[model samples]
Target: MGAFGRNHARVYQQLQQAGSVRLVGVVDPDTARADAIAREFGCKSFGSVEQMLTTHSEVQAASVAVPTVLHREVARALMEAGVDVLIEKPVAATLGEADELLRVALEHKRVAQVGHLERFNPAVRATLPLINRPMFFEVHRLSVFSPRALDVDVVLDLMIHDLDVVLTFVKSEVKEIRAVGLPILSGKVDIANVRIEFESGCVANFTASRVSTERVRKLRFFQAGQYISVDYARQDVLVCSVGSAVGAAHSFATDANEWGTRPSVNPQIQMAKPPITAEEPLLAEIKAFLRSVRDRSRPAVSLEDGRKALELGLAILAEIGRHAGRIAVGKG
Candidate 1:
């Protein structure tokens, strides 16, 4: 099992221990790792999806944590065989591949979900009711150098999380995009900065880097008079507002006694952190997937949502390419 695949297995085991679902089996080309995970989780391991399916014909749901290129092929096979799927992010390598996946899921009438794990973060969940009319956003996701997920650029590997969240919050069509990216340790883009304008007059700036020395995952946004911040790693949210802006839009209830009060420079400005119930995001995502599969209902993060994020990521990549071309031409 790879990085995320192992995580999926661990969460499934947790779910199993909680009496929510059964850990049917695991599949990996590397049978040793598969067997090790299976033993640790108290489940069976198979060398391939076909082998797993053949062994457990009653398998109803599965998670596709394979490479981006193999997503379509593996998911298509599973869906066609009457298995619901929760595929990892960047749905497919290309938009056409994403479309094919959409068709397959619809045609098979299978409940398909994309694994945009950050959507389940408690901070994101806590920020939902506070959103009034978000006008501006500043987001950053940086990670120390890693050799993982190098098949795609930083935009897809990392920034797409913010793209999906921002898109969900704005609920507006993207009007313009300006982006620049560069390669570092990997052959693909390792760092990128992007500016996006939505038709609703909202603007967002995103910076993602896989070559950073330290790790940071944070998003800050402003509405009319309120500013909100989310810390993905800490699963925390802080809301700051001035004068009548406090609780003007939403009835944000916070127990100041437990959270404590911190005085601001301006007496009129108030700051508070809304209550957050911290839970492992991966655990929540798997629980949601199991719920969808059990109820035979739509997924929280559908394949269409995944495709939209991928579309935006690809557009950013295209812009980066064009920007690089201009630099090359100038040098010539």
Candidate 2:
């Protein structure tokens, strides 16, 4: 919700281009914002979810972009109205709310997708094919501080992205998790790092900061025989593997010293760097949503996936609190 609503509107417009979906209506508490989006998409604007559902009977699906605290109310209303939902991530502020949403969606037989946009990133798609047996992974996502999402900690707003990605890659249960964070610009923790140990013996080290010098979004995979790095910003993939090769002869002159000798150096390296093709991930995500709507198939990022990401994020937040308590006691 918040600025993310703008992205939801844009993605909906892109979905219209495929002729499978249409922007039926837009809703935001801010009338100006809702009107602006409606005008841009040639749709009607409603100031409340209740009014939107009542006025737009043709809306079979909705993009719920409300704040975390209001997610349960809005999503439940939409699901009860027989509309599929695509809710923005950290599905709900609390596990109870997320679980209730899941239950209602199931009871109503509605599709509730979560917006984890990284799953649609082209780099992720390209890297998925190359990964054989990932033993370890690292990710860093940093952004300059903004006051838009001060209600939630950095783990939910920032670290959850990497958590979803790691969970997708490992596909195993988490054995343990350790996290530490501190508040900098906002009352909530603005910088956080987490270490997750999966039952598959794979570990993921992740760091996310909303207060940073510059934005950095990257992931690294260390698997057997190779290391892969994907720079989401640059859309670049670099693969390094072990190789053996002979070094080219170097021309050297040792005239005065007879004992001077040239030592042979082994140059064993081969690097294959490929330019990653850029595609609009939001467009792909919306297209998938449309496909799910039409075919009644499961979403790429389903409600269950969102629940897991939220659970891990909440666990990290709890860990942060525990660490903070330790520091307070030490100071006393």
Q: Rate the local accuracy (lDDT) of all candidates.
A: 0.92, 0.83
lDDT of 1 by residue, 275-296 (tens): 9999999999989999999998
For model 1 the TM-score comes to 0.93
Per-candidate RMSD, Å: 6.2, 7.6
Candidate 1 — worst ten consecutive residues by lDDT sum?
258-267
Where is the poorest 10-residue window by lDDT in model 2? 245-254
Stretches > 4 Å off in candidate 2? 244-267
TM-score for candidate 2, please give it.
0.90
Report the error of model 2 at residue 78, Å: 0.6
Off by over 4 Å in 1: 245-267
- Model 2 residue 138 CA deviation in Å: 2.1
Clashes of 2: 0
Question: Per-residue lDDT for 292 in model 1?
Answer: 96
lDDT of 2 by residue, 1-332 (tens): 25888788877876677676788778888899889888887778889988987777778988887877778899999999999988888799999999999999999999889988888888887777787767788899999987786778989988888899888878889898888999998989999888888897788889999999999999998765567898877767888864533322222223535222545566455678765679887777877877788788999999999999999999989988998999999999
TM values, all candidates:
0.93, 0.90
